[model samples]
Target: MSGGDARQISVRTKDRNSEERSEQLAPPLRRDQSDSITYRSFLRVRAYAVMTKPRVMELLLVTTVPTMILAHGGPPNLPLIVATLMGGAASSGSASAFNMYLDRDMDAQMRRTSGRPLVTGEVAPRSGLLFAWILAVSSTVWFWCLVNYLAAALSVCAILWYVVVYTILLKRRTEQNIVWGGIAGCFPVVIGWASATGTVSWPAVILFLVIFFWTPAHYWPLSVKYGEDYRRVGVPMLGAIHGIEHVAKRVIAYAVATATASLLLIPVAGMSWTYATVAVVGGAWFVGEGLRLQAAARRAEAAARPMRMFVVSNAYLALLFAAVAIDTLVKHRFS
Candidate 1:
């Protein structure tokens, strides 16, 4: 009754305690693993999406490729082009995300921009800004190391101008904000050209002008379409400040100016008949759109759709530059 009974009872007690502890721990371990997996997966997807930055990054990347082509005359710098595009993508992506953050208030007001992940609360403001900062800093360093000092510095300037000057200072201040802020976007081509040539030249300046003049032509029409929204937000766009009819005339004026500047490139940028033909045809058509916009001012939104030429303008520049680059390359290759 003594020793054997005590030993058997103690063993049973220890075994039961161990079984209880194991049962208690099992669900929690499984739950912990499941939660960890879910959180990690959400983070991973967010990282890839990077707060809806891929769109702006892609456009920035596209903006540089033509400069690379024209720089070497025919695609001599594939690696450099790739690096510059990536760096620019990062830099512009950061700027764009930061812009969304800064303009979150305005963005919330505008139906066009209200659906952003940050505004929609799918992602947090802090997280978006942090992603932007990473892209901006990383792209700056990348451009500095891979491209050149001037290119890196200019890239930084673009971001600073966009964030500080255009977004913070100019946007809410004056109706001419778009005009000045347009400078921020116009400089990317200059930076791209300098990254290749290692110096700013007349050609780069001309490309800059092309974008500069085209900026008003591009944005003013759209502004007319959204004048009411901008007025509600206190953003003094051309259409918001001046009458829509005035905005339309300015769009025409800017289009003509852009076309005239584009023609100068036939000699300066060393473009050929191919480029000239595109300039004439596309430019004439673009100008015609502006005129239509000016005339269609009396009509409603549907009537002016023909004059809303952003997509066409984009294609025009892309193809026009491409043709010039190809022609320049052919000439260089043959020579």
Candidate 2:
């Protein structure tokens, strides 16, 4: 061979060798293996999302924006609304994650909670704990930086109250646990008001009490449906310990209080007819459902359908808040 041809052959050999070595160092992944990895990652993400109890967060957020509108007396700053909502979501998610971690043991025993990430071993307890702390710290900082000091402080307090006071101290201790522990859930409206006004007011207090009274009315029926699950886990939920008739009476009382507190908003915030009609009509419907549950309890019917009241309570709160927002916008547009 000519000298040039031999050199070319040598370089070609070297290039082939280099390519072979690179393949050996990092073998190409099989398609199936790549698919398996992607599926696992998706499941991990879903598990994390479930740990946050997003359904509960949705209910908390339902009260927030309307309170902001009432406190602003109209549509507030768009950026401020977005920031407060994001911060509130993060704070709520952090608290829920912490609760899941702490209650994993109880969760494992309860059918309602058996599928939880920590209980099902979808997320390791230690990793879940770390995730909770990271979210708590990051969300508090997000509030401080993006929202305001009052919002930030309230967010921190909410996390502490939910994780420390509710989950750790109260949940397993008393039937009244939800009554007092529900205070954490009430914070969203107050935080919304604070975010809008930089302080809490009588209207905010009224809304806070509305949520407080509405909570038992909202939760007790679900507890009734799942009372056995709670009893199996040795949790002291009222529905698990008390007679259906007794639980129904309490639900009616709280429903009445919720309706009353909602009406107080009309005078305190000077809400218009739109809000007044919703509060009056929706409140009556809400209390009526409670009474219906009580009647079912009196009959000792096997299918008392307590869940009907639960469903109605959710719709009531959402519609009432929607009325609040709509009323404010109507007033703003005309005035």
Candidate 3:
């Protein structure tokens, strides 16, 4: 072979090697493909969040922080509070995910729940179950290691009560489902108090009972709004089986019970004027909303606005707990 031919071959081989190196250095995906992957990842994360039922978790956490504050007589340890909240949130998420998985069939038939991640096929059933288990185990472990064993045990119990007792056993079986199943929602207050004090106290018990009574009042109005949804799904929520008047009457009884429980906390906790005022005023307003609901039901059942009571119930709880925390903080500051 000639010298030129040898040189040309060497140059071609070097060029080919350099091209391969450049190819290897290039990004695996194009910009559009990377964007697509990122969007999919965001969607997956959102789907998982939806499975956790963030709104319900928000209400649970609302009760938790104030109870912790009241238990500590002020702000609790920041790290402890954060850890407890995180674990509680995870536990709640796990239970809600489990509920979505278990009730996917019913949810598909209900308008209110039709948009859930499970019902909408945003998350696979098996994947959701696995996520639930992961959350349940991880949350329990997180509580055990970061918080205390009492909190951990409570976390586990909350999950089991919500999933097994409420979702599995009661939800499909009776119109009184929420009356019993709502027990799970009240666990946060006790767990919060336990996390702060290491034992449940009278105040905690009273607060728990407050939630116990408040649950039916809070949820029954919502059930009234979604009565048809529950009926279609074969879930015998109170409003589904009972007449609006009957449901409204029950709501009034529970509302009065909730208000009475709130007042009990003032004496039991020795809460100050701030709490006293809020409790009396808030409780009256709450009961009044229930009364309004009942009157509306009596005047024209078709025109009754149960959702008005539902909104009021939420505001009432938030205000009551806020008063609890504020009263503690104010007293602590003055002292």
RMSD, candidate 3, Å = 8.6
The candidate that achieves the highest lDDT relative to the unseen native structure: 3
Question: Candidate 3: deviation at residue 126, Å?
Answer: 0.6
Candidate 1 lDDT over 1-335, as tens digits, reads: 79999999999999999999999877664455536978868865675375546754544555567776777677756788888887887777878878888998888888777777777776678888888899889999999899999999999999999899999999999988888898888767888887888888887788788888888788877777787889899998887777656777888888888889889888887787878888899899988877777677667644766335766667776776776677777787888
Question: What TM-score does candidate 3 get on C-alpha atoms?
Answer: 0.89
Give the C-alpha miss distance for residue 202 in model 2, angstroms.
0.9
For TM-score, candidate 1 versus 3, the one ahead is 3
Candidate 2 lDDT, 171-263, residue by residue in tens: 998998999999999999999999999999999999889999999889988898899999998888998998778888999999999999999
Off by over 4 Å in 1: 1-53, 299-302
TM-score (C-alpha, index-matched) for candidate 2:
0.89
Instruction: List, residue by residue over 65-90, the lDDT tens digit for candidate 3.
Output: 99999999999989999999999999
Superposed Cα deviation of residue 329, candidate 3 (Å): 0.6
In order, what lDDT does every prediction score? 0.79, 0.91, 0.92
